[model samples]
Target: MFKLLLFCFLIGITVGIGLLTTFLYANTSIVNQVFLRDKYSKLQCIWLLVFLTGCSLLLYYTFSSQALYYSLIFMNPSLEPLQFWDALWVVGITDFVVKFYFMGLKCLILLVPSVMMSHKCKGFWYMCLEEISQYYCTLVSTPVWFRYLIDYGAQTSRAEWHFGILLALLYLIIKLFFVFGQWKTSADVLRLFFTQPSYGMAATKRQCSEAEDICAICQAEFTKPIVLVCQHIFCEECICLWFNREKTCPLCRTVISSHNHKYKDGATSLQLRLF
Candidate 1:
């Protein structure tokens, strides 16, 4: 199984790189269009480069551990140890490379909208929050405008005041807490985009006592766990129902005070809901 997965990873990395490279080379016009639209400063460019490298390393490290964990299963079995070691080597390296390529794909599709929104706004912070709120709302309601609103902060969403508070707090953090504000600028925007993935997935990250990936309410494993801003992952249905009745998150006991529904991207981001 490990060997097969490794082989698949190699194939995926090859295909991903080939596909993205072709897109870049073939559609030079589109590439130029994106650059023109999202013109980053030298500092921002350096930050992005450093950030991507770090994230890639993190992904590689995480998946490598997973690979090692899976390989241990073979050690206890009657499998050929030498063959298994070879398989682990091939698969682990391939997994890292594929993740690298996939990150590039994400940059093309996800980064543009996020960066463009980040740069163009007067209310970068709250707009970021509202963007997250919309993303969270889409997971459970089956509403007509779920995806559209989350990505765009629909007519009903409180994007204006949402962005307002964010901007004000950001200003306060930067002005008063200047020493700890090195990450405030880019972090404000990233906190918004990732807090609510622009896709239809509701992946809020709140904490749950159980690690089984089963919803406490329904006791069903989610097809995709909705990670709330709370660093908790749960069945989307459970959290949605919980959020609707009580203005508090289920696991963390954090008040769901803001109808705006957004937090940052850390354990300290304060367990909050975006959708």
Candidate 2:
């Protein structure tokens, strides 16, 4: 009774996470961990990963041992005794391919959200990934164990970042092809667009003279101009604060009819021209 109860509890916990992971896999809702908000959800995914691997391994050994019993081991006339040479040549390839398969699968859960989220996470991207992961997971038909060995095995220490690297390579190949085509077309368009005779000589070194306008106060670029309603310019920031009340031009010191004045740009440059 005690052991059965423990088993039931573990099964319940696993089912809960399975439901949660499936639901939230696409939900970008914040994981809500104070410091690790963006990353905590991923860390939580560690649970799904453990569950997947354990189930896969258990089912795989069960089926394979039973189905391929004698053929897998005892030397037949064909390929006797699985030995050092077998391990070196045959096992190496098989192991790599199998591991690679799992790593590739790991990429679905690992890289999809990770790469998708930060810069630009789109709904369609997740949708496409879900369809693919589910589709392949279903198509394999073999127990999930086979999928685990092939995909997950490649993801770990056996090939450190194996799937990530492979996925990157695949993307690079695709991007390079797309980029090459785009550049080829853009180059042709650029050639035709720039050939018009109205286009002045390709490269004329026309020199520009810098304006010598200097501020009256700081003597700066006059870069900071405070032109007034009468089109008179002042450097009020450089000047004293009393000018706002003066209602008169400073340089000419002419008393203006009204206190309201406009900047040369036609803006009511009130306090802006003062303080």
Give Cα-based local distance difference scores for all models.
Answer: 0.40, 0.34
lDDT score, candidate 2, position 15: 43
**lDDT (Cα) of model 1:** 0.40
Q: Model 1: per-residue lDDT, tens digit, 127-203?
A: 35433333232221222112222323223368854654465455444444533443454455566445542212465
Give the TM-score comparing model 1 with the true structure, all chains together: 0.21
Q: Output the worst ten-in-a-row residue range by lDDT, candidate 2.
A: 266-275
Clashes of each: 17, 9
All candidates: TM-score:
0.21, 0.23
Please provide, for model 2 over 190-209, each residue's C-alpha lDDT reduced to its tens digit, 9 standing for 90 to 100. Answer: 34334311101111112101
